[model samples]
Target: MYDPAYGATDADLITFMGEEVREESAALGRRWFLVAELAGRRFPEMVGRQMYCADSISSVAAEISPVLNISHSRAVWQVETAITLRDRHPQVFKRLCRGLIDYRMVSMIVARTDNVADDVMVELDEAMAGRVEKWMKLSKNKLRDRIDLFIAEFDPAAVRVPPDADKHRYIDIDPGDTAGTAFVSGRLHAEDGAALDQRLDALADTVCSNDPRTKSQRRADACGPLARGEATLACQCGLDDCPARANRAAANAAVIHVLAEQGTIAGTSDKPGYLPGFGVLPAQSVRNLLPAAQTKPVTVPTADTAAQTGYRPNATLTEFLRWRDLTCRWPGCDKPVQRCDIDHTVPWPYGPTHPSNTKHYCRIHHITKTFNTGAGGFTDEQLPDGTIVLTAPTGHTYRSQAHGASMFPALRQPTGTVETTPLPPESPDRIAMMPRRRQTREQDRRERIATERRKRTEIITEQQRQHQAWLAATYEPPPF
Candidate 1:
């Protein structure tokens, strides 16, 4: 709170100024904690209005987004991270409050330890004691390295990555300050990077005689035509063993996995199409990704939907299960289905290869389930509609429902809790004729609002119906 006037030549001015900045940062952290506390405290008011937990949290996101001029996702992250900082690392939270460390330094610790076991976190808290200042002084990467060392020493599993870490890759499109464009960034495996480098470099040099764009700009420009299907993709480096060395048709290179309806794919409807791993893509993008998106004929099984005798599924069945689960069926893991082990809810041979009996799970969660299932740690039960409820060792159960925009967006989740009340016929209509006319903006907004509610409700209703039918058929009620 020191406001030094222009001519103040205090001997310790530099030190004092630095101290002020740190103090202010600590104050900011404390303020953020208060804000998150407010959100939790206000939850009841929103829920009392019959809003689902997800919607209530979205209220928090909406409130903070414009106030901070940040994206809703970023706003939600700030709130979630603050809550985790306090819940998982109270000592570090205190350090943040006292200005002993800045939020980013605390965030480094949070990232490394959030997914770790609770007991491991307690050990981490003990190990990190009295070192807050040291961590704060180090560069971010150095601090992360220190945290990694601690995780390795205390709980080696805490730093463990999936066996398929090489498959871990993603692209991020960051919107830049100057409008209409985004900075596309991504990480690829070494071989893939080398392949992409050759392809991009070749494209960049193609027009070198007249192109005045910078190398980075040229590469960026070159990616557009390839994605939009205007240009081809191939390894021009002539490297024999290069990953992209094999020639692929332009369409095949940009082929994306989508589960769009025949109507949506045919341009008859504009409902956003579902892309596995990625949620929904605009209709045009879906159409462009696979213009001739053919619908594979699905056999209408005479037997139960969940019934099959084989242990391993065939190609068609595999695709069905992948798109069916979308991600790992573990309570909160979102590992893409492509990277999961299709696991049986009921042990194999006993469970059968039916659709109902199996779900996808990442390796870690699959291992977790292997040990967790049966008599002790956890139990996985699949509902009639493929929603899974995990019964924990503590007896508290959690549900993981299949959700996507494909015909059934009924998997929308309400974080922290799942409200199972079916969404009523509250709207006269939820759709409008497209090219997305200007007249129905209000209706579109209303539909989006109802969507989250309806999805959760539908799943809940299905769960209730299945449970009720089971009880009626099997469990006999006493004369109480």
Candidate 2:
């Protein structure tokens, strides 16, 4: 695989591959524009890896990127410029180029190319052409923003607002305001309201003072108490001699002092306005507390999934949630198993149930891994650092590095000067080619749109089936 004649490094491979693709395009009477799409699909692992490990375009080209072709054609000239300028302030260019590439692929994928109605297909092609024009002329940041705006515009089911209903109206209970009858039956004054606002503001200020402690820090803090409590419960004679117990005691004392300073409770009430242990209290009182009311809507999944998977008649939902969370205990990827089908490392039906017996990946990655099995999709192994080591299908093993360590490295500007060679002015031959180029681009854009329409039709059909399944399984149409 590393034969020098074929080009040894990743970059060499990319260049060679790109040349081959260009040749193929020419031989087949295809335009060079489709080469980008082919590159993205054929080398997704390489592309994805570079994106994960790169900081700037210059650094990526030097250390990771696998691109090969460069041109000054209308369709890909801007892209070529962005890539070639990798050595000159690369981060900005990399971001812009990647954004353009990502949206182009995503829009095509999400639009589903085959079945869109004729008029809709025409409109989509027009929109794609406009986006490409912006890409050709705009700065990287502007391009990124435009791509984001475009995605937002086409995202399905984005606005799910329900119709306004009488029951949805807000109810005001302020005693001074003309509203519903008060439950407390107390006289509300301006000062009292002001006082309440002040207290809430203070509480918010204290709670939101700094960023929340990360999961690791919180776990470390919890471990100290847990270890000490376990020791004490075990009645270990070492408890009296243990430094851990002493530290725990000192921490508790400090907590008590902080609680005393901060007001642990409000004034007690017989018929008093508020109860003692309410409102702005000491930090200790609320230290381990989660607010009873949460702002974010909780997605309580239906319990039917496990039942559908052929569980017992009376299975509790708690088990399903636990199983879902446990599917990928590999730190960052906590995808619910209900949404992901299981992948048996040893191949299920033949493999037994064990912790090491299975792993889970989403549909796309699962298929990709299967496709790249010869290259090295992923393998199960635990690293010395307690992180799981999964070999990618590309024959590269990526251990679960510190959550942040796997990210692309910082960008480095190119030290050498980039030669600025302006293109020669267009001749009559080049001018004559302009109309042909425009026509080719328009045709390619139309083809892509057509492809997207088909994909969308397939998706819509799938959605319809899912809807029907839902209706049949859980819903009963009213006496039709």
Most lDDT-accurate candidate: 1
Q: Please provide, for model 2 over 119-224, each residue's C-alpha lDDT reduced to its tens digit, 9 standing for 90 to 100.
A: 4434444464445534645665565456445443554322122233543444342332222112223334657656744543332222111325443343333432
List runs of model 1 lying over 4 Å from the truth.
1-103, 107-221, 224-255, 290-306, 405-480
The count of residue-pair clashes in candidate 2 stands at 22
Worst 10 residues of 1 by lDDT: 411-420
Model 1, span 1-480: residue lDDT tens: 444576546766888888887898789788778867867775675443222223444445544543454544566677777777766787878878888788678777877664456667776886785687877778877888888788767755456332345555787865454423456678788897898888887766555233456777778767854675644333344555654434333443355566765676779988776656446666776777564445564332223343555778766557666766787776545667878898977767656665566678766456545543344345777755567887764466776676541244432221121113332332323211111234332345355435533554566578789999998899877896
lDDT of each: 0.61, 0.34
TM-score of 2: 0.25
lDDT of 1: 0.61
Residue 98, candidate 2: how far off, in angstroms? 15
Instruction: Identify the runs in model 2 with alpha carbons over 4 angstroms from their true place.
Output: 1-338, 375-378, 382-387, 401-480
Give the local distance difference test score of model 2. Answer: 0.34
